[model samples]
Target: MNCADMLNNLDSSIDTLHTRTKLSEVILKKGISKKDELIEYLRAELSEAFDCRVGFWLQGSRKSHTLIKPVDKNSSYDIDVGVYLFFDAEDEGLSASEIKSTLKYALASYCEINDEPTLQDSKNACEGLKYSAFLTIDTPIYYIAHDNATPMLATDSGWVDSDPKAIQKWLTDAQDTDDKRALMKRIVRYLKAWINVKWNGTEHKKIPSLAINILVARHLKQFEREDDSFIHSTLSICEELEGFFKVENPLNGQDILTLTYEAEVFAHEKLTELKAACLEANDASELQKCLIFSRLFEHYFPQIELSAFNRISGLPVTVTVPELTINHYDKDDKHIRTLNINEVTVKKGESLTFSITNKAHFNQYCSAHWTVRNIGSQANDANDIGHKVVSSITESHQRGAAYTGSHTIECMIFNGATVVGANCIKVTVKPAFPVLRRKKIFKGFRR
Candidate 1:
């Protein structure tokens, strides 16, 4: 079986997991309304307390429509709302620590009004007023120049150049269509889920969701199968991280992986393990694939009943199998290179010749029958199952790499009506020139 149906079912199952963690429309609407009310209240309080003009806007996952509850049920949803203070030539003496202190103090009264005891402060944001057990809003202060230059965030150490909304715009504008955009979100959510499950309740440093989003957007590619799209992105990311464990903020070109050297190595090893497991799942049988997914995703994926295809039939006495030789040819039919049967990856639009040589000496009138089977969305579109015999005299059978997927060709030696020897070869056909890079703006952040 191609396992497409099972994979589609797995996709739906993943959506179910996402739905469980994703905030509902009604809840989000209420959260937004409450958030806006708090923003207005804080705007008034800060302006009166600090004697400076300020602006408020939503940012982060909420604004980008990529918010999801953390995999750990104990963790609350974090919504980031930026508070910008426009500065002129006269406000040069203001300090980041002082501004953060004043903001936290002002939030104390609001938290009191909301029946919260105290306000919490982080390196970049002040956390205040939990709307519920599952939600908390974070206010990160920023100072904007009079000429409307890049905003500087009030960090614990000092003011640092930051534009919280730039990432949202970069992520949203990267995709061209709504479907592509939705798929991007799904991909990001899946990666987040993996990380959430990995480091839950552990002392190890957790990978930030921002880094995951950047990597997903960087490596995302659309495939005919949803499973293929996900596996390819994951494998591509693993390959990249294997060489170097670093990711840059798309807008300002800053390395976002702020983990200790030990932590970085740990995360890299774990991600490499994830890549290996994903590849194993891709090549596994249907039932085994479901189990691997369950373990990889913490049982969030569902199990589906799948049927396996019998690629071979008829049993015979032990005998030496026939030898199959494969050669790749260019457009002009010139011999380019011979492919190893164990690792044959052909490029689409190229021509390949498969010849069968009888290695076992059998004194009988034997005929060589060839069968080609194509598997994947591309093959399915062509409606080619390739069960019938294509060549009976089998000096060589030439075929074009017309599709991009894993396909197989088999040669069976038949003595009258009984099977004698058989050999099968699996070939992987890839696109002529695979798309490994995105827009030029994103090029610097990759390497």
Candidate 2:
């Protein structure tokens, strides 16, 4: 591929990597539902405890949909939820510690009632609820001024001016008139993913997401090519920061980076690394560019197949196995020919066998690994779909006798971690027949 075509393909791959799939969307929806439930519980409890109304709102990257999934599966993703107390601090004689303590008490009660683990008080700003090893919800207590609706976060020092709503609005407004806003957001996600990869399993101080957002929004410029735009915008931000590193809160123009000197240094170092990588990628040959990108992005960037790259570079491709086919079998050991439409139907509790065969030239070797996944259903229990590996074929059975639903079954053939070929078949499962008691009649004595 030419430079433009290669860069275009890389951009497309980045977009695919960043786009949230339907399953992921469903998972996030479930997470938000739980967050909403907890928020409601806390609101009621705090209202009862303080004898006043309490309001809540969402903030941060989760609210903006710019959150990047962590490279490591065990890494934590946070959703920020703000609880606003609708009473004057002066009237209640409430201090920041008091507010934090009250909110912690309410959350503790909530955890007890729901049979969940107790929330941890960070004591810096927010209380954390660990939903899973990979997910957390950070609830920050805020007090609303009686005279106005100004929001203030309860910190150890005192009430600090915090306007998450205004900041979120500013971010939204920054992209309002820009035609390349979508691409801008995608680039931001890419940058965040890069950060995650760069800082994985390290104790190094990382750049705050808000600070990154602020820098990108302030310095990002549009270009005809996405690669050029990403490179130029990133370099611009880095170079600008060399003089002085400061990111202001969009709402009040207060410097948010003043207290984060270590993070600023970290950002500079990472950006410098990125600059070097971009330079290398720009100077490398077409086939080498792919390798450069793969190194820069690690596993997140899809690697170009060696065969394809060899072909492009005028080298003889050695792979003889060029075609893969999937065959399905029924319960009676009968081969069921898959139609061109690629759809399958089975009764509940029936087992289906799938085999992948490779068409190869003489004296060529081929190997394959199989993976099956349910695409649309919420109940993704492993026990519901049991699979056993027998030789090269995989036999998967739907064990749920009463289950009736349509779910997409995706069968993939992998050459190591890279997907070589794949097939998706929509499986419609019919409900099992209800058992009925037969009326018994004696042969000689009729009823």
Candidate 3:
């Protein structure tokens, strides 16, 4: 059916939303009343949060809260809601985290009966609130996953959301391409943060954690861009998750999903096999490791790697400096140029040098450069400049032949990168040796 048709169906659902039946302790009438009132209060408060800007309220709990079992007069109950903020630039363009911190104070200020606000203002981000088209959040206390959220209180539409398969099909379907994709993004975020209160034996009663939520949002966002194969999209999600969670797998680049009819089906069995295979696949490439771990991440996580709550880390600019040098210490291999110095051991400010020749490995008459970086340094941040070109001598083709230091020198040679086996050649400036000065004498001076 068309969106209009679907929307018409929703219209009927809306009518019956207010008309209620008693579900255990919750009177549907009273619940709806309470919900409406709460929404109004929220609308007003969120306006001031962004300095009088409008905020939106998307009701995931569009139905009345009905207890699964009967509730007594004084029993605790669960209530979950989703609220999106429409900022008014009050944050000076600060991050969503900063805005969240600000909004907390705003909510407290408004809800305050006294010096303190009643309940802590909750700010959850499903994705890109910092640079978002609009701020968004998806919250549910009722269900573990968005695909299985408690259906809205509607008459014809019933309550639960449509099938995941249906949603997937609709996105790829030529008819509802746009709408379906829009929804897929929403689904990713929701699944990422879904309580999954009963997942693989997790018992988090509160909302979903930050990392999982980000994971879901990211993967779903990826799935939205897919038009080729569902399995590919799913597998890509796994790959991303492996990187995201820093998980190691054996199937990094392998398309294990193609081995099965579909991913969702073999997710469980494939997980066991892949895990075992990863264990046995000793000395596998990082790609192979990523392959195995991606699948595991795919099965467990529904979100992406980055979000407002848990921004994904940027890629590490890795540069390796091979320990390549001429063995000046070895009598047989010693050369006139590029003499290997002592092993490098000093702080950054302390300088070190190596003897080099006119035909040094790092020297270039034309196009060669050296790189230096602090790789694998625990104290260095990822943003630290890990690669640098120390010196490049274009004058190597001249008559100058380097007898002491080399003609070509590369600074990046200091980057601490080795190819598996410790192929390192350490270099440090040697202590200067004193040479005795002899007085000028003629050839017959011995007489």
Candidate 4:
């Protein structure tokens, strides 16, 4: 049931912006230099004209370390930069719209001289500068009164009481207080990757990354392995979202998941399906676990090769291990034809037999020790791992597919405990499709 190695491989596979640290050391060095220049220009222009002190800070995923690259290569990466204008007693009367307009004008001037990036009126909160086809920086305007007041964000209607830094602090503090290995950040990245694969286009309404960040932070837990931690956290959140699915902002206590009823229902259904898939994967063997995760995360998750798990470990390191190929047989003792070794599948409630062929000839007196390793929750609960070793000359092992899981069997040919040949085969047992029966109801009515 433990797929720790595969999970670790997946953790490293995701191409998040944080994973671009090495690349950022080069490319983002220029990006940051441009950002600094733009900031200096804005501060000089705004302070000279409006006669107010200006401050700036990074917010959103870039600051939280949960930023993921766009699933579509053509899409731009968004950087949220919070701009705070500290107004003196004289400039306190500036309206929210006026404050936003002043910021836009300054940004427009910078863009005009730069000649590389263009400006757009990203209504409501921020003014966006499309630095390049692949990148954008959003400047959300805010103001503080000299009398000491909370920061207010400029919106279409009016100024709103908010602080972008507070939200980031909440996430940072929560993560800092918890797992030191940054498991929370890893989980958030995984969920964001899932979101990108499931709903990244205009075809579907997107779930706010803020909501996911908050929900995951609230329900986060640490386990000995990342896979177990992820599954438990997902299940915890999905279970809590049973009645009214709402994710509140940790800093302000406001429902951040503001989605339409239909969209909300759709999201809940998808998350529920994800929870079920996680459970199913927990009950699967190593290879099956990889398949389940691959499907869950689409092309973003790695596809595992059978050769990775085709290792034999019984012989000594100095000894030259021999090779063997496995053959399958049905309950009728009939040869089950299979083109590949690991592609064997059987329906539950059926019995299958396995035999090995020693490609490297061993002594005739060599004993064939067959070992059956049953995996999955069902098998664990049954407490019947089939660890019972059978010694036979033919190297035949028979087992019933009583439980649905990915199970394996191994044959080691040993001459007085010194192994000569070894082989293992993975078998997937799945539930058989139910057969429906047609019954006669009324004369012409079908039930």
Candidate 5:
């Protein structure tokens, strides 16, 4: 089916897996110091003005770890800024609208979503809240909301945060090259590299919200350290994710976030390949991981010998686990086929019985093709008549024995435009009994 469906199915099939808390202690990360400096200054002003300890902060990609993203390998751009406010979820009963009105009153003419308010909601209702002021670049101090915690800005209203314009300006600022965003991106890259160098040595599960990003960044660096042949596959993943995120060329070429993801996913594969690359790796830890990956590749990517089925015994045909995904639509178009007659041979007057199944029916549950081909005589022989696939058989059927001599019969299958296989059956017809039925217990006849 689809990814969503697969996820749903998997969830239903397995017991709930308890996800341990990933980040035990929250550490304010680098890459947003400039933005943070301005915001913190504002928070101090507002807190002093309103007598509250609530602070305006940053989160998301930056808070998770790094600040400015890696330089765009292809070009340069501004950073993405997200703001957060620390507050208890349950301290107030004021409606979201009231908070927004208060924020607008405090910070007039700020850039904010007029059509909708930005408010972050949890499945569970929250307690104690602190709101943030929105700032247009022109008016960095214009406030928006107060006492609300969730801080993503929206067109109308949601969680209140710093003005989008103000944040965007800081993101584009060129003078402060060593600011938080750049530093964070570097830190994330280092973390990722560290993860790569120390996969088994350290447990990644203990890392922060953006620990995986570290993994991605490190893996990307690995692509640069190793062989050139893999450059494209890694590039393909980078481009693919870049396209997925709709990142610019410069941004895309500069980092390995997506490639690292794919690498980690196929971590077993890459690790195994790296291990086999050389026996001279000085690090025993790396060597051990290399061996682990090698074993994984051997186990998972084991060569699959895809082959067509040749038996016609009505026995259900199935491939092995991690089985081959095969299509038999060579020139012809079909996916699944059913067993049929005419080409199905039995001894003279011998009855043949066959059955069909719905084991692999997916959505839509369309139909299957059942045909009998008689390779009578030879290729293109006149006696060799072929029956085109006509109907979708749901169950089994018995066909009276054939009157013709032995012939090769095949039951072809199809699904949509793809062909599944052609199962062959050999039937040899015996000579018929004499038609004299005068109650004769003739010789060679069992009474």
Candidate 6:
């Protein structure tokens, strides 16, 4: 394999391991739904308890889709929810501490009434709701400015002006304007996953998610090639970190390095290690590069069996091809048709499943790799276009609604370490059908 193919394989492997599986996605959605319900209940309860208006919105990695699964299955996940109390402090003679106390009281009352666990002690910025050992919600109380609609957090010191929405808006705008934003997000997740995998049991403060986002957004260098861009952006940020370890808040231009000196030192050291790994991978052979990446990513990287190939022989090996089949399904979970040709047309939101059958009579092994590439006229990054699920020799993918144009799904069957057979199918996805609501009719009462 050449450099491009090697990099493609690496990218696919990382995506397959790092991206959330369909079941995990469903679980996450359910968690978010429960959190949303809790937030709504809190809004109403606080309003009733304090005799003031209250509202809330989400502001964190949850909104940005950069959240990664916990490295350990038992580890906890947190969602940051900002609760806004819409009342003037001076007019109502309410202090920051008073507001926080009132909010806590309301939350406690809510827990008691709902027969749920009470929140723990309030942190410097927020109060935590412990749903389980593996899930928690952090709600920070804020006051909305009547004049300008700015949000001020209730802190121990005093009410401090802070608008998380501003940062969210900045990220949204940056992603919308840059064509390479999807790649940037993936790189961010990769870095986060690396941190998770490497420092699973370490006591040092895990790098803040916001800090990684800021660094990636500020230092990412766009390139024509996806792998080149990933390497360039990661190396660029790592090099910059060698000079200093401060991450500026995009909203207020303030340094948010709250970690201790020892933590900072450890962060710099880890970044250096990452930089070295990237450099080594850049200079190594294709297979060697894959091994280096596997080391860097550790358990999060999928394992590829390479013992069947002999490095000492240094001779070409012929492999047998495996029989492949493609099955298509509609949104309603009904089978649309079985595809025999290399091309098919379907509406958006349709699903496709690919399966492989080992045809070798004996003494052969089969492993399959699948990838989908956007062949449309206006393709951004093909890897970022659709969602795929890879399970052993079988792979499944669903066409996204926004992905209208053309795409090609390719499957390569490997007999041991050698590519034995390859096949691709072209997909022409038409626009999704729009929902239409029936007009309501009213009976006339006129005489």
Candidate 2 minimal-lDDT segment of 10 residues: 381-390
lDDT of 4 at 229: 82
Each candidate's number of clashing pairs is: 1, 0, 29, 0, 56, 0
The TM-score that candidate 1 achieves is 0.63
Model with the higher lDDT, candidate 2 or 3: 2
Q: Candidate order by lDDT, highest to lowest?
A: 1, 4, 6, 2, 5, 3
Ranking by TM-score: 2, 6, 1, 4, 3, 5
Best by TM-score: 2
Model 6 ranges with Cα > 4 A deviation: 1-15, 20-23, 113-121, 175-178, 308-447
For all predicted structures, in order, the TM-scores are: 0.63, 0.65, 0.25, 0.62, 0.23, 0.64
Model 1, global lDDT:
0.68
Candidate 5, 1-447: lDDT as tens digits: 111121112343221100000111111122133344435544554465444454443333434333221111121112233323243322444444443444434333211422222232221112111123211111111223354322333213343333433333433342244443333343343333323333433333222224344333323322222222122223433444433532221221322233344444554443334433322222223223222222222211111111223231232363111111111121122323333332432334445544444334422333333333332222112212222233453533333443455543333344553234433445554545546567856578566
| Candidate 1 segments whose C-alpha is farther than 4 A from its true place | 1-15, 116-118, 124-132, 303-447
Which model scores highest in lDDT? 1
In order, what is each prediction's RMSD in angstroms? 22.0, 9.8, 25.6, 21.8, 24.8, 11.7
lDDT on C-alpha atoms for all candidate structures: 0.68, 0.60, 0.29, 0.66, 0.31, 0.65
Query: Which 10-residue window of candidate 1 scores lowest in summed lDDT?
Result: 304-313
Q: Which stretches of candidate 4 lie over 4 Å from their true place?
A: 9-24, 88-91, 175-181, 306-447
TM-score of 5: 0.23
Give candidate 4's TM-score: 0.62
Q: List the residue pairs that clash in candidate 1.
A: 1-309
Query: Residue 141 in candidate 4 has what lDDT?
Result: 83
Residue 176 Cα positional deviation in candidate 6, in Å, after optimal superposition: 5.5
